[model samples]
Target: MQATPVNPHSSPLVRVALLAYTFLIVYASWYPFSDWHTIGLSPLAYFSEALPRYWTFFDVSINVLGYIPFGILLMLACYPWLPRRWAALLCMLAGSLVSGTMEAVQTYLPSRVPSILDFITNCSGLFIGILMGCVLTPWLLQKDLLRQIRVRWFVPSMSNGLIIVALWPLAQIYPQGYMFGLGQLVPVLSNWLNIYLGIPIDLGSFIRQGAQLSIEQYWLSETIITCCGLIGAVLLFLCLLQPKAPKARLVTLLIFICLGVKSLALALLFKPEHAYSWFSPGAQAGLLVGCLMLYGLAFTPARVQRHLAIFMLTISLLVINFVPGNPYFTDTLSTWVQGKFLNFNGAAQFLAILWPWLAIWFLLHYQPAKSTNPA
Candidate 1:
């Protein structure tokens, strides 16, 4: 039996809902309402704070429940455009990325601590959302409310772009130590370059020495950031472009290379030690996989690329989890948990160990393109 297709017109509200839910989760995750201290509970709180045994139903429920709407709305927004079965899988992968980012951010928050259980719960919420969308969209289409809403505001061509623009700032939160914008990296890099090479570039020193940054530094940073944004937009545009336009592929590749060069140059000035690190074999492999995914998006008619990316990510994660090099990986799970049970700091350390692989996974699976032609 052929499945019914979702109306693209129905997507704007769904997108808005998804965005709202994402905002709420981010806000709530940062500001917990009922921690032990706030709730007049003991500092020796055992239920939520106890190590290893901290797997309470309350925590699980909250985490999972919080993300369910995110998953459902994302699915609704992408539905019929994204393959239905693949939508669920993609949601799970995306959910994991969001959970991972949220957990990473929690490290900096004084009140919040990261946890594996949260990851599990967030992913589960995405799964539930996908389930709900699969079942609910068809029924909703039979009603007049969705159609009425769609008529007023949903413009298919612009909706996805708007969503992407909204998400750009959120993506910035992933790279560590980046605050305000990429502008911050310039001064640090300028200082490093001036110190190491003994070349007197006073711009960096001036900023640090309490002198207001000259228009040059500010404009340069803004220009670089604007270029970076354009590169990213082009890449996404390429994904959505018709496969017949081979020129789009070339353009996207050029944009990517340009951005890579720009990033490398900035890194050299700011952190020379890590500037070439992106070229390391593991990182290169991830890059290759990402390129391949993009190529698939351009050329493939079937939606297999999405599933393939998900599979690759899952396999990569499994390898990272079980590989022997890291002490966390080599140590027995029981021993590791016993040593730092229920502590956010410990969970954060654990996450840090796995983050490289997780990053690689996202790179491999990151698809900004809307799949218009369904398999």
Candidate 2:
């Protein structure tokens, strides 16, 4: 008699990934979520409406690319609970339903136009994504080599920690005044208050109280933010990894990957001529100091690492938010092209704004358990 394979288990990471992507989709679709006056048109009118008169390959591609990950994540989340065929069907239905709902809601927004073509393109992406997921899921989650590797490398109960690590590079995609600075909420909040509430308050400036920061001071602030941010993020990764894991190699890879992501994002968002602009003198010094710190702390206890990560993150946040804006960084922002990647920019900004907070939360609350093979 043939032996039956053990039932695959669901991962909280997969479920959280699906939910996070869905939130991004909703946020991107209805971005700048203001001005809610009714247009007196049926939300479903797009179902029967003609294709948009003016459309471009870029729009179609964006619509498709946006939801491909949604489909892939949704199907992966379903794989443990349902048969493959059923999961595939459910992913298609869920992706289409989400696309339809977003389109319908867009009818109410004057800035956004609901389009049948977008819906069709989104469904096409979902179908393609589901196919890709089906092919990859077996080897990825079926108690296989990948599963064994994950089990061996990471500590137990790190589903969310892993997700945070994965998103660290992505959070760097959004431009920041300081390299690796992830959470600077005061300026964003100040802008929102000024724009929507008619309040004229620059919180960062208020905190500085008209004291003009010198070029040397600004450089010092940037260096502090960069070093603390990198150290905190790398230590978070180390805390989640097993004692036997390759800490130096993984940390090296992560730092390089984050820098590459930042460079590529800058190139895409600004002119290619400014691709390496983030490699400032302060950033270089911060990177060097952060690496030396990480090397020394490589063998620290996971609990100590977690606490240090929180402390570093807290210091970075305080400095980045209170420090006055750099004049040069403000000038660079004027060159950013937000025309085509509005949704992408919004998503990246969202990730950048929230990533550090999420990491700190994970580090504070995550309680590692004895390592064992996942069911």
Candidate 3:
């Protein structure tokens, strides 16, 4: 079917979104990114194996579904700049290239098993995703739905909300000392530097260990961190929402989404029986306080919201990074075995740890459009 031709102007947002997702896909596939020795066996040798035995539907489903975004995003990214046919062909070809790269790299990893069946499924998914994009783009682009959504729900010239919204759920995949504690990178970076640079170092731990905490102090720290983290993320998102938008409702929805992601992660990581184990007294207190804060500030101007968000984020990161890791949190980490899942785990942790900082940076540079859209 022919596409509905509109203006040929390319959206930088689409390009950025595509690149961000591409990085995630590559990270998910090559996670851990270590162990380089290889046998004489060709990486392509997997293609010659006998047909794959009965594989679980979950793995097959996830593999096929995961690549769909790659196709969709790639096609959309190219739609404005290239002919329709060329754009789609390039999109699928890029996806195939990515799949091939992942499979080839898996040959060196002792944990992963390279399978041609997986590659085939991925290609199929990419193709389907391209078709979906072709059908959907005409409506999404031609109808001006995204623009309407931006004006109604987001700050006119900013996309900080979109990026944060996407990362909010993915960040929950990693365990944090406090609820909504997204940026906790100092310790991890410290450890990495210590290992590679051969120095005993960790800025956060060093600062945190300066004072020992009692039971009450630990509880207080957790409460403060959680409250600040929650308030900061919500305000940051609110800063992106238009003044006329439903700030309270959207903030409520954001809170629910974050909690939902956390709950899902807990269920997956542990068991359904212990899914609620993360809801502690301190977290409950923080959630209550944070919601109150959101309600109070939901009426503030977007600029004021941005300033408050910056302040809130600065405090949250300082406390979270400076404070020692919760000893209680160690119990949860015990169940996590870094094997084949190491790569995915590592990537998720990186996102969870660095996310808040990324948001802060984005907010710092964010600017609202100077002119109003003509009616």
Candidate 4:
């Protein structure tokens, strides 16, 4: 019996995941990014201050749960560079360093309170994550089931593309004006201008030229947005996959995952009864059409698929950002309870608003060395 050959190269996917998660951690920690002032105390005041008098199990759990993935990814990323034991130690130290820096900076933010408890809990999460990674990394990166599947299905160089595709479902966690609609920068830009430049601008409405859209117009806009967004995201993934990959199964799974995330987000943010409210007639028609389009394009040339992905993403981004906000969606948003998950919702909104843009960038510039499908 021959021993299975394990790829000796470092996994780019793990490295990309580590970097992405680190960015998310930084963004989530300093959410809102405003109202910074120095209180004449050292930034390290949190280090000397006693434990926070007010803390909850939920807060501690959230802190812990947040850095676990970071720790695992960091450990794996250090692999093929550093020894396993060293990588574990470095992961813990790096996690503590990052948490401490975040806490130190929070001292200047009026809305954020730096706490030692958070630092400790974050370290604990990193420790746990390192241990878990130790147990799983060998099997995953070596000759294991997951490694086999990845090698067999996906292109060898798909670090960036894979990350973008994986984040698609997560981007749907934030409520949107239309189903599968994302990258609406108009509102975000408008708010920024209003705050900083005192220029009250509604870019979306400006694009509409003060014209009110009828019910039919809204439906048409939504259907176009949904179809384009779905095709863009699914085809982006398809471009990364090998010719022999299970295109149908994977595409269906991706759509279902996005739908499930969107439904769960709606239920959690609003009422459970309204979970499937996004499944409007326009969305249904869009989904059907998108599915049919993808089925036909499954066997298309990889280069054509990549170009179509870029084109679809560009269309979705333009339509989603230019279309005025839907009144019905506004009313539904009014009912949302943004209580404990304010920071989380903010991060999700950031992802939703930026995902399509990132996907477009990837599609435009990233040409995988192995993206060509082998017959």
Model 1 stretches with alpha carbons more than 4 Å out:
1-6, 32-51, 142-145, 149-375
lDDT of 1 by residue, 1-375 (tens): 135554554545566758766765665565432332344433223225434554667567756766787887877776646556666667768777777777666655556666656666788877887789777766665354665543332223534433443343333222222111222334345566777798667553444464343544433333333333333333443433444445454555554554455355335223444444324333344444455545445454323433443444344333322221212212322222222222222322223233333333443545444433333
**RMSD after CA superposition, every candidate:** 17.8, 3.1, 3.0, 3.6
Candidate 3: residue 10 Cα off by (Å): 4.5
Q: Model 4: what TM-score?
A: 0.89
Whichever of 3 and 4 has more TM-score, that candidate is: 4
| Tens digit of per-residue lDDT, candidate 3, span 1-375 | 554454476556677778888888888877667776687789989888876886767567768888898888887777766666777888888889889889888888776778888899889889999998887676666676666767666656565457766687789878787777778878778888888898888677577667777877777777887888887788777767665677667777777877887887777676675567668877888788878887788777777877888788888888887777777787776875444244478778989887888878877887644324343
Q: Best candidate, TM-score-wise?
A: 2
Q: Rate residue 87 of model 3 by lDDT.
A: 75
Candidate 4: pairs in clash: none
Error of 3 at 280 (Å): 1.4
Poorly placed runs, candidate 3 (over 4 Å): 2-10, 51-55, 79-90, 108-113, 197-205, 337-340, 368-375
State the C-alpha lDDT per candidate: 0.47, 0.84, 0.76, 0.84
The estimated TM-scores of all candidates read 0.35, 0.91, 0.86, 0.89
Q: What is the number of backbone collisions in each predicted candidate, taken in the order shown? A: 5, 0, 2, 0
lDDT string for model 2 (99-191, tens) is: 999989988888788889999999988888898888767767785655566678888778778789989998998889889878989988998
